[model samples]
Target chain A: MSEPNTREITYLEAVREALTQEMRRDPSVFLLGEDIGVYGGAFGVTRGMLEEFGPERVRDTPISEAAIAGAATGAALMGMRPVMEIMFMDFITIAMNQLVNQAAKIRFMFGGKASIPMVIRTPAGSGTGAAAQHCQSLEAWFINVPGIKVVAPATPYDAKGLLIAAIRDNNPVLFMEHKLLYRTKGPVPEELYSIPLGQAVVRREGRDATVLAYSVMVPRALEAAEQLSREGIELEVIDLRSLKPLDQATIVASVSKTGRVLIVHEAPRTGGFGGELAAVIAESEAFDYLDAPIRRLAGRDIPIPYNRTLERAAVPQVEDIVAAARALAQEGR
Target chain B: MTEFVPHPILDPAVIPRGSQQLLRELPKERLAWMLQKMCEIRYFEEKAEELYVRGLVHGTMHLSIGQEASSVGSIAALRPDDLIIHHHRGHGHTIAKGADLKRMMAEFLGKECGYCRGRGGSMHIADIPGGNLGATGVVGSGIPTAVGIALALQMRRSPQVLLAFFGDGAVNLGEFHEALNMAAIWKLPVVFICENNQYGMSGPAKVMCAVQPLSVRAIAYNMPGQTVDGNDVLAVYQVTQAAVERARRGEGPAFIENYTYRWRGHSKSDRNVYRTQAEIDEWKQRCPIARFKQLLIEAHVLTPEEVETIDAQAKMAIERAAEEALVCPEPSPENLEAEVYAP
Candidate 1:
């Protein structure tokens, strides 16, 4: 099958397109999870899949996340690349044993004779006001586990490319899709391409301060960077596409050039992805280029409340990111 | 229909001679092989207990003291290509799946010659090439992995079956129930073997399970379930043979509850504060080893002299394996980070 010519689509469409393309390419590839078929998906990412391939290939499993994950892991080990659609990112906690214990460690425990080439796609981040249970940015949980690759794509280009790459990779990959960015559009190439799992992309170039962000935070950081540009604060923005195998080189390069760094994420400030980025910079040669202690603008440690105002307050808004960037830019080395 | 009595089926004195025809059917050579494997497992675990007490085995040890029949007999029914995922009390399964004794001993010693290259000690040893995927310290975790392997075999059009072994405690876990349900629904070629050794480390199976028989739970998943004499090697072997054949023939997964008892505590450090000594004595009387030896004697397959010779040979083999493992070099500190992930 030839690649689709649509260059611009929603993040959800990009994900659906990736699944469609991969399923067509490999007979062993299948999708299973709640509401992934007939109903399209909880987020409608798998809409029309049932019509295209039917339920055998695009299966709608029970509400048991553990079973869904275990089934995917089993299927993956049996020479199938199962792409599982977790309805909500928070529900991933229910399947941690299979994801963290079984899927991630099987290959290594079996001395590399086996591999779980499975991908778990879930909608993550707060902002939709789905509350604490449904909306969460739990990519950090997966980052700590070995043998599995974790990717949080912020753009349609990345969403499609990385999904394709994950399906093809020889290890388990957790693909966390931002719930807020599913409808957001970006230019994705028509040719079949893949963004490597551990590589980071420079979203913007600047010289004053390096703004590192991931998933939904990338767009917020980009919006803040646009406003900061007018104030003569050239903010360099980095999209950490893959959290597990973090692209430390890109982060260090930008920090080295700008001499200032500010990390931003939707997860809570304490023990969040920002802490990892901060530690990486502090431990790397880029620490010498610091103009001030690295600042982290992140969500407050609390359940994502139901109210819109509280939800917005819990996460780092654009203004909050802008203020943090200004503070890093003005500080002395 | 004959009414089933709730008793350890390995008690040859109670079981009618006709009921034990399966145990006597094995030829002399096969009986000797089964006896050798049971002795290997028993002696290996006995040695492991000694090493653990002396603080030589680094991690916790889940020894298979009195439940050798489940692994030895059940695994004997599987082909070399068939896969098995063992539990923490998995040395029997590993050896039954054909893991090398030298490497198996070295693994407990954390030597470079260990099957996991010293990364995984007793509880986590894995030999994938030999068809033993690995043993999990976490209960019920291997059930899903085995189901997945069976699913893989079905996809590849292979007739190989997957034998997933877990303990009585694991059956209460959601993963166990979920994996079994999925395998049943998909008609996946897998056998769910529950080594019901009376207790899950102080928690007796009777208290955890509402129904007396664990095999009855399989009907809920719409699959064939059976209860076998876990202590009797022949009964365990016959039931497992039927399950494996059913799976290979695309008849779907089967549930098996092997009724047995563990003579050791849950782990090495366990002091028997949970149960009474009288109960242990009661189970020890029905030990599968003694029952098998008696049956072999009555069948004229082995005399007293040969039984002693076999015991001596088993002891010698253990001494040689232990000596080699003790002298084997400990894994280099530089190799500590190895095998964490595939490069």
Candidate 2:
């Protein structure tokens, strides 16, 4: 077949297209969340879906996160693919028992007789002035869970593809989206397509140093790589779309070739997903090729502040990634 | 707000308890089967307790000894195709729902022949084909799940109903209220059955709940709510039947709080520190099995000899199951990682 036609679309539009296309393709797939029906969701990611699929398919649930999560799990157990949205990542704490204890453990605890085919889509990271309660990156919490697969997409292309993969996968998936990436547009295919869950994408190719990033940090890492390229310091940017089933091969290959690594994320530095990536690289054969100590540039170990300056300071900016990669590349010399 | 008056349907002192008129109308064979099932549950729990004490069973097991009527009656009210979501103390509920006796025993014994392949011992037993969605160890965690199941059923316009069984402790959980309100607003075909066994672990219900009747809380969700004498099998059966019918008719969810008592302490570790012996004796005197048996005999539905024969048959079945479970092989570690996800 000829190459599929493509067009530019925002990350939010891509997410909606994926949901609409998947629901039309599969009758069992449905969406549920607080203000998802007529309200089109908190971030308008599910706009027009209610009218397209009607109220049954686009369920507007009560302001009960536990019920949304638990109900999705239950529906999944009963052979329905439910895509639930938790308006903000911070509110996920309320439904932790259902997602972590029940949904994550059901298949293993039930002797594998049941498979929970469900996806929880939520907006994460600190950029919007939503403050401490709303602005937080909590993907690290679910990455540690065994049965659940965590996916964080940076661009519209990956967002649509990865979400389709998540909806179709026979496992509970945590799909984390960056609030700032909603309006960001990218070239996306007109037709439906899916990117494999665990495969990492090489956004930019380089050999001087490797920068591992995901979600919002991906664009930032790419920006840093551009600036670093002018200074004659090349940085390979690897976007880990899937966290649980980590693309260790790509990570190892990049780290080995570059001989230096810098892990970046919008989450806190301590106990963040960056630490896990660092450990993975260190444990692999890539450790022997390390020219400098594996560095992790991440958000500070504090709640995201409301002030834009402080919020920017709390998380790693493009400049921070550039500086960290430049210093790591220089250390190799 | 309505006053917290105990539902008259649940009053123990109500006249015509286990109504002979109702018993007279029921088929003799059906009555015999119900009595037999209740006896089997009682005998199975007794044997399980013995096995636990003898160190044959590994983990702590929750026994539904005196609450057999509540388990049997509510389950008996549903069609075989109907679904049930159970709480931690759901062994009797499983048995009442017609789970294989040998497999259940093997599961408790951690044998490969168990329903969950020895993974989910007692608290997490499930029989999917048999319509038992399994039991949860977490209190009230399964309530919202049941609502979701009901929603799916409603969406498909299936004639089936889902019953979510939890204890009085679960009613106090936020999930319970959320699920009830959702089920009520959506008009999902579900029945929320609260087997109020008077205590939650070591805490008494009086101390935990603000309302006298837990069913009263259902009124806040705009659903029909009632309390029933849990020890009266017929009462529990009739109330559950009404709720099940209402759900089947698409009239929305209904809540039934069965007032019952557990004869044993919570799990194998309890020493009965929170309860008095006199209280236990008083509740035991209201034994559901004995009450049902007396009702059957007084109504001439079962002769004393037939009742003895049924008891003997149930005991024999339990013995055979225990023997089969004892000989079943332990799960091999070769495929330990299997079933963590769908293949």
Candidate 3:
């Protein structure tokens, strides 16, 4: 239950509130991105922040993603908590060296003498008809690299708290925000609160089967679980909040009790994060309790198409999760 | 335009100076210290080569044996607290910024007592407390990194300046232009120094770059640019000192191209197939340390005896550092991932 004064706000607003509160509380917190200052960010998450913080704090940089990312790494070394925004997660491919090689490895390369207190906030996943170049969920790309924290918040509340935690985190963090979730409203407190990184929240509890989801997939899993409960087939929907330093224990417990699991995401399934999750579960003690072959419900191994119907078919819909979970629950009994 | 002057310092006019004003104004001890640091880098690099040849050191090393004067002279202009973030070929820059010879050597030897606890080897030595922010082996990566640190300092309203060092080939990198524009537009306190070592690895920078005297790229970014004879310690000192003051005063960033050469190959794996032997011998005749030693003796800044004593002390210092580093314990395997994330 949210406390009093906890008004319903969109995921975008929660992110802005977290940033606004942090900047007011600390002098070092600042924002940087293309057209972020005057244009108020591509998604309007930082709208009106420019007027409040002034030009020095809310900087609009050139369209060079490499420079923007590298500059964030540098500023973080000197004790500035920089929150840099990339226009789209797809464009982050151009800035991979800076993010993966430099920002992620700078601390360990310097033997931990350096603290990169920075965040790379970008809009990830697809549904806006932005097509292939603009729509992609690139969290798996970042999770592969060590020394950087990765967060994908499903609810407005988690978005605010997790972003605050990322900003306060002394290491580099990649904050992946789904484009479609910006308008999704949920109860969020007006006061500032931070959620610790690497903690998973079980959105729904059931014993029939386990559904592992994150970011935009969590809400879909919940809808699917609600449908499955009508047929007396209940699913425990878990939101894996932090991708790196993953909350493996929570996943193991749910899998051990349920005896079946379904990992879901919107990214292509060929080399997706679901593979990593499956390996983690298979290697853990949860493997002994599994009653069925593990199943994965993820995006097709193709780019997110421009057509609305094809796009919907590319990733898992609520019905897809319901069907996948239903199949897992009935098998190996 | 008629001919590409590979070593521009051989020409008197190409030095780009009215006079040796800094050499005249600097105290006797400061001048001696500059020369002393240059020698120390020379001896240290030579000892590193000796260790590499004897199989004590693994991995390739980018030895800055010929560019010591460029490093020593420019770093001498900054205060102890000022910062520096540099590129791959960074041994001279690290030592000139006051790296403990023993700790640096231990790092080279992959010992636990090393600066990075044996995590980062030769190309990534960092002395954080001494203002050496660290170096990356990635080409041209330090450009925006230096600007970032400078931006942080600017936001804090601090007067500390940063010196960014890269090679001649870094001029062609997109990060160079992007970072320069950011530093210029933000008016960041950064002094960009490009050690034009004539070649980047085996690729001739002349063929790689469309621009001669890469500092001219600074014009596009609206920053002041100058090229100096990197071998002339006094000339490099004069140029960097002015740029450091301009940055400290918040006048914005400056681009300085120090025309020098690397006596050794790019790294230990270099086959020496790109450049001619005669060209290498000719540049060796223009050795920065030897030239600086002659200048100091002729300028009466130090007697011949004093210069020899400094050289002898440097050699002995390197000897002592290697001796200490040879016996240091290796980093334990259990603690490999302990430093991946900060506490």
Which residue pairs clash within candidate 1?
A74-B148, A78-B152
- Listed per candidate, the RMSD to the true structure in angstroms reads 3.7, 2.2, 2.6
- First chain TM-score in every candidate? 0.97, 0.98, 0.99
Which candidate leads in DockQ? 3
- Among all windows of 10 consecutive residues in model 2 chain A, the one with the lowest summed lDDT is A1-10
Clashing pairs in model 3, backbone N/Cα/C closer than 3 A: none
lDDT of each: 0.85, 0.90, 0.90
Q: Which of candidates 1 and 3 reaches a greater DockQ?
A: 3
Cα displacement (angstroms), candidate 3, residue B181, comes to 0.9
Off by over 4 Å in 2: A1-4, B1-18
The pairs that clash in candidate 2 are: none
Q: State the weakest 10-residue window (summed lDDT) of model 1 chain B.
A: B6-15
Q: What docking class should model 3 receive?
A: medium
Name the regions of candidate 1 deviating beyond 4 angstroms.
A1-6, A51-54, A110-113, B1-20, B23-27, B302-309, B335-338
User: What's the TM-score of each model vs. the native?
Assistant: 0.93, 0.97, 0.97
Q: 1 or 2, which is superior by DockQ?
A: 2
| Residues B265-320, model 2: lDDT tens digits | 99999999999999999999999999999988988899999999999999999999
